[model samples]
Target chain A: MSHIPLEEGVPGIRSLVMYRPDTGKPLYELAQVLLRDESPLSPAERELIATYVSHKNTCKFCASSHAAAARYLFDQESGVVDLVLDDYQSAPISDKLKALLTIAGRVQEDARTVSDEDVALARSFGANDRDIHDTVLIAATFCMFNRYVDGLATLTPTEDAAYAQMGERMGTIGYVLPQKPA
Target chain B: MSHIPLESHLPGITGLLEYRQDSAKPIRELTQLLLRGESTLTEAERELIATLVSSRNQCRFCTTAHKSAADILLGESETCEMVINDFESAPVGEKMKSLLAIAAHVQKNGKNVTEGDVIRARNCGATDREIHDTVLIAALFCLYNKYVDGMASFTPTDPAFYKKLGERITTVGYNRLPGGYDQLKTQS
Candidate 1:
């Protein structure tokens, strides 16, 4: 088995956060607000979006961790989650969700890449201005999150169990933690 | 006068787009599609989110170009665009707009971020899915745009007229030759 380098092991932006967890408190707090905050999107849907982008970016750690979070949200079979990650349009979701995910893909590209036709399609599915705004925000944020993690060569736990553990923690306690292990 | 470093002195991302006219065609095309793609977001709003995130990341070139784009869509007299970029909560359009701007700020951070603050902010107007999807998309693309410009070290350029020029270029043709200098010529 090939041993991964120490610098390349941590997942997401944990290293950057860990290095300045004290300083990053504000940032972490903000994240909690965004996810746990009141909105139409459920925790599961949010995680699913993150998972989708992580999968697209091919970030192993984000993919695993977020996937675990999403799986925890759903009480049924994991096939649907898998399908959403693979191809959201064909997944077992409403037209609204399909429209949202389509916007997410555009976010992965350039904003200019998204077109009026795309907006009209979503509108046909009944996506309002708020929904549109949030979609762009999510896509744009993930881009930065992905970079911050990959940029620092953060460690990504490979074990499925590890991510599962994380999922439980996130689901139960939200994003903030009393103590974090380095 | 301090001479600009030859390497760092390229116009800007927009300039490079013009400079490397051929290669940039793809990104320009991609930008157009993204701006007008089938999403819930409007072209102006989408561009605003992108510009805000780029500014937070401190990418001078992207900030310049996207802001220019925002100004064009929103209008030159719009101070709210600046408010959004300066701080998501700096008193802008509406609760929904604030939510989107805040989402962009969070994107500059990382995803391990969820708390009552963002929730409360979104609750003011944003939906749960909106917050979630916003963060996801913003975070994902920040990586991409950054990767491209960072890797190639693309120059950032946006003039008072650049936005209009970009708008024209975006609408008309990205490659009919803008009628300029040899420096505008790309490596290809």
Candidate 2:
């Protein structure tokens, strides 16, 4: 009953990473800049937002992978991820992070939904202008990323262990092309 | 200068979650199940789509997190995430991803973008009724998440470290709560 011809036999990262290199040059460059560039937000916080937003969206791939990464950052603290995933307002975190996540949520729903009060709250938390700017970019970019993955009818690994392993490698290596699927 | 009260933070998963929990929540729950539960689409692909849609919506929280996670799922390969953050045409995958990006673009711009050609392209990618179902789900979530984050005005962390942390987080675990911020204030 599925419309797309999903190559289920491909297996894990190998199957998902099978995009044309030439086709993805620009996107690759942008992602590199966004993830690796010198910005105000920490890598962990940024990724946390991504995971949180994905969870809100209920994107399984995003929620699982980001959750693993978040756990790695906080030393396998599933509670932190759960807090954000379950209810950011109730999550035990800095006011600044809460402010940022709040902004991220707005980006997920509607940019116009972001109000002046939101900016002032972020300011109170010591978030600078650049940090605020980057937040918008991160939110915007995720929207694109989420659609891209889901749109393609791409494969998701069934095993939780697989995501954990992938998280371990990703945590250390960042995003480099793997030779084969682990 | 702000219209809403900066101090008035909405507490605890919004009353919406609680209300839905009491009843058999339909919309959000249905969306969550479709997104996280078993389906024809792969987890990575679905995340990719979610990330892409969030990115387009400028949802820093969702996009950055999912990008890193997507990176891991792809064996730390930045290609797919890259394609998502910027150009969709650049390929490491299929036309379907690109097409869905188009759908996200439509979502970003508004309903005016649902063109005939785009629909045809989605069809070509093997996307069908279910795929359409998922796409709508992905698009709708970004809208909701964006509304929450934007209005609340949450901050985003830096990038270099964000990526580093993302990679480092591969093995730890999931769903944690680090206590520091004050409890949510109820304003009813």
Candidate 3:
């Protein structure tokens, strides 16, 4: 059961969103700009960043949700998302992303830990300032989302079926949820 | 100087926000809405929530800045400090202390906040709206703390800067943060 009496049938951040919609619109709008918009990072890469942060935060709902989205988008090897989450350093990904993930991991634990050397490594791997900026933003934003969902103890579906449906919707339709206020 | 090439010399999000104020409009707008906008929670309470989270995150810049804001809004320069030192023994009402406890759990780990916690807050006369906003404030500060610390932004060491800024925000509100929103409007 959730801390507050949220509407039934909604899960994760959606339940939280439905509970207090005043905050959700802006949060969703920020998500659209960060994840769904045009940027140097692909949607999958962005989702990967979000997943990594969520995983580090130990928010199972957020990790599984974004991982499903990335898996749908990547569409390559099975359990690749799991492999990346287990260890992105050894996961099959670009060096730029690997370096960026290092920074994201530092951000997940404590922002101050990400040092000048981290930025240099990412830069050397050809991640420009924008890439670096977005990676940090994605990581930072997911921490908020993860906490919001878990702090309230929102419903997290156990079945992969829900995640598959959600992943397909997010992958095809993108992050803009209908502002049809609850 | 900042870890990154931010325009302002002051450390923390101020410099980062100044570095690319365009990208900061969403953040600024969000801040204005939550902290300054009308709601069940007072701006003082909201700022306290922000301050507590920053303190837990150990983000030097945000803790200083927001504690100043909460102090100014509450018209007590020492209340925020007392709360930070010990929220339970602080002079705040039981309800606020409970809310702060919930917020602290959010800072450490959200899942740790339990059903019993919510009941305790409600038992203290907090409304659903108040509880709802507290959760948002806690989560929002996590985003903010990370943003400031992730980039190694500059944090002002001077106490006067925060005192003045805090006083100004308590009066003029966040939308009119000097050239911040004004400059962004014209540029965009």
Instruction: Give the whole-model CA lDDT for all candidates, comma-separated.
Output: 0.56, 0.55, 0.83
Query: Where does candidate 1 stray beyond 4 Å?
Result: A1-11, A177-182, B1-62, B65-188
Say which prediction, candidate 2 or candidate 3, comes out ahead on DockQ.
3
| Range of the 10 consecutive residues with the lowest summed lDDT in candidate 1 chain B | B1-10
Give the TM-score of candidate 3 (chain A).
0.95
The B-chain TM-score of model 1 reads 0.60
DockQ per candidate, 2 decimals = 0.07, 0.09, 0.72
Better of 1 and 2 by DockQ: 2
Highest DockQ: give the candidate number: 3
lDDT of 3 by residue, B1-188 (tens): 34457655345676666655545666777778888898878889899889989998999888998988898788786788988888888888899999999999998888989888888999999987787778878988999899988987777788987886677667876563665534433331
lDDT of 1 by residue, A98-178 (tens): 877776776665544555677678778877654554455455445656644543335777778999988777766777733
lDDT of model 2, residue B7 = 33
Query: Which residue segments of model 2 deviate by more than 4 Å?
Result: A1-17, A76-78, A178-182, B1-188
> What tens-digit string does per-residue lDDT give for candidate 2 at A21-122?
321333334444555557777667777877876665555666687677767766746578777887888888889989988887876667667777788899
TM-score top scorer? 3
Q: Tens digits of per-residue lDDT for model 2 on B1-188?
A: 22233332322123222222221133234334445555566655665666676666665655676677667766765666576656456454555554565556545432223445355656566445344544555644554455345434433466654464345334332212133113423312
Model 1 over residues B3-59: C-alpha lDDT tens digits? Answer: 111233334444434433433443444444445544455566666666666665566
